[model samples]
Target: MARRRKGRAISGVLLLNKPTGISSNKALQKVRAMLFASKGGHTGNLDPMATGLLPLCFGEATKFSSYLLDADKAYIACARLGQVSDTGDADGEIIHERSVPELSIEQLQQVMQGFVGAIEQVPPMYSALKQNGQPLYKLAREGKTVERKARPVTIYSIELINWQAPDLTFSVRCSKGTYVRTLAEDIGEQLGCGAHLISLHRTHTGGFEAAEMISMDQLQQVRDDEGSIDHYLLPADILVSHFAKKNLSAAETARILHGQDIANTENLTGMVRLYDPEQQFLGLAEASETGRLMPRRLIVTDETVTD
Candidate 1:
């Protein structure tokens, strides 16, 4: 294993309460510059109009980012009824509008119930999905259309937060890769009224919550405190607590470092968190057979690889 130097490049996870109007990558860049991280990456992408929990990995922690991207997410989003946007969000122009029909709470509640559970959704044209050599958004900008297949997605829970006039706010907990904008459009279609997202705030992702996130102002305060900025960072395994843990002895650690699989521990199944004797995070591994843990991903040096 490569030894990390102190004050060179910090390693760990930064839970950022991403503010609205900033793309997820842009937010990562800002945090990277603030920490002066030599390497960094975010688990998932949040739209520019959305705000909330965005977990950023710095230095060696970037190796484990893929696991975070696979976790579920929760968000609070407001959708405007009787109005349809070209981009399915407030950033798009309103291309269609109609008067809000008299909708009773019970009737609206019934429509929401139908949206629960597993469903297939066709991705919107104004998405980052790539086709041929260009992004779908580029085609949408040029007034071109293409057939998009529906993808299966799951909704764990959705609750109506509040509603007044044409504005309806709802909280949704869904699997990763789900599109809340598409959900809003589908809900509108079910209600016989077009809709689009007006505001979106993610509350949770990859087991990280907004309440645990630090703001840019708080980070600045820590930075100005002289040398305590590193104290604000959480351990890289924070989000991986959901997985089982395996403590490796010196011999086992040596074997793993040599890329050899060891006998699995009984009762251990699925992905697990691997640690050194001192409980320092080593990386991630999967349990196979009755007694063997095979390395799935390891935290190597921060040498960037390009094709």
Candidate 2:
């Protein structure tokens, strides 16, 4: 017999304001425990030294977590100019240093403009990227340096926020998989002074901003008050809010949930948001060019019928 997991089969997304000094998974665990949720997942990872917005998915919301993971992210980073760290961030040991030249804000902005577009970046060794099924950070901890290919990533925008001697702060909106530490290092290299990120904070990801984020302390207060934290959770379908919404008849809903593909002739030719007659979110379906609405991830068995 299969053993079932314990806890509430709740479904929704939590916009957590992740704290520094804890891994993303650890933060998720804390939130999951508070909610007593049986299943939970984080959209993407944030380094222990980083903080700010981290979207967490519980139950059925996990099905659409990938969409947020693949979405663009924005961050504000503090860089220590004239110093280079082996890990490209403050958490690593300093390996090199150089003199920093005094510069005007205009000059700095001009240099930053050059980076506000598509650019190739080499992932830092102290990263989670895998090689031979082993995380690169593991190899780094053992003092090993391996060749890494420079990957193309778009920096939609980059602007200087503050400049105080060797410690400079900047904000950037970039495509997924971008390493802000590498960006700081690259910018330093351009100015003839090496640099490494001192701190980083994600302010925006997917279509969410930091404004809606809840802190662990606030959650604990609510829990102490014996309140339902479920109220803090966003609907599961919020993950796929960009998809075209389609309301299905009771018969169509039943057929779709039963692993059947219905006709998709509503001018939607991609992933579509599905809703039952009562307007409860069903799940997502892929609409093909051949006019078939194929069930992809359904909520019928996902334990929560999010409204």
Candidate 3:
């Protein structure tokens, strides 16, 4: 006999304003416990020292979490010049210090402009990136260092928001894998002064924004007052809202659900969101150039058509 899973089958996405000092998984677990969700996962990892806008997906939403993982991200980061850390952030030990040279705003802006567009960055040793099935951070703690190849990442935009002598704050919008800490360190090196990240707060990820995020305290209060967290959940379909949507007839919906390709009169190519005649979200389908809509990821509801 198959063993049953624990917790309720809650399904939806929670925009959590993750607080500092907790791992992303820790936040997901806490939210899962609060909602009594059977299965939950986070779109990406936010360092324990960093906080803000973490999307937690429960139940069927977990299936689409990978799409968010590859989406763009934005952050407000504070870097302290004149010091370098072993881990590139405040969590690491200070390894070196340098004298901060008097720099004008124009000079700083000029340096920031240089980082815009495609740039190569070596992954930090303190990162979660694995080498030979071992996380780099684990090797870092063991006093071992390894060579990492420079990977190309796009920095859509970087604007200096505040500057207070040794402390500088900047807002960054970049591709999925861009490391703000490495950018900070590289900026410092270019300025002829060592630096380390003092604070970081992700303000946006994918289609979600910080303004839409709820804090843990607020979530707890809502749970205590309302006795249900389902009210705050955005539909699981919101994850793929960026794609073109194709509504299907009742017959078409049934055909697609049964893993059968449907005629693609619309001739749309690439991934698309599929909806049934009643406006219920069916799932994702890929439109091939050959005029066929192929089932990609389908949701299972009581109304789902079976073979």
Q: Give the TM-score of candidate 2.
A: 0.96
What ranges in model 1 sit over 4 Å off? 1-7, 224-227, 300-307
Can you rank all candidates by lDDT, best first? 3, 2, 1
Number of colliding residue pairs in each model: 4, 0, 0
Which model, 1 or 3, shows the larger TM-score?
3
lDDT of 3 by residue, 23-76 (tens): 999999999999999999999999999989999999888888999999999999
lDDT scores of the candidates, listed in order: 0.84, 0.91, 0.93
lDDT for residue 217 in candidate 3, whole number 0-100? 96
lDDT string for model 1 (1-307, tens) is 9876433467899898888888899998888888877788999889999888888889778878888888999999999999999999999999999888888878777888788899998999998888898899999999999999999999998888888968888999998789999999889888888899999998998777888988877887777876566776788778678998999897777777666788775568998888878776777788886577887776663321222
Clash-forming residue pairs, model 2:
none
What value does the lDDT take at residue 15 in candidate 1? 90
Candidate 3 TM-score to native:
0.97
| Distance from true location, Cα of 57 in model 1, Å | 0.7
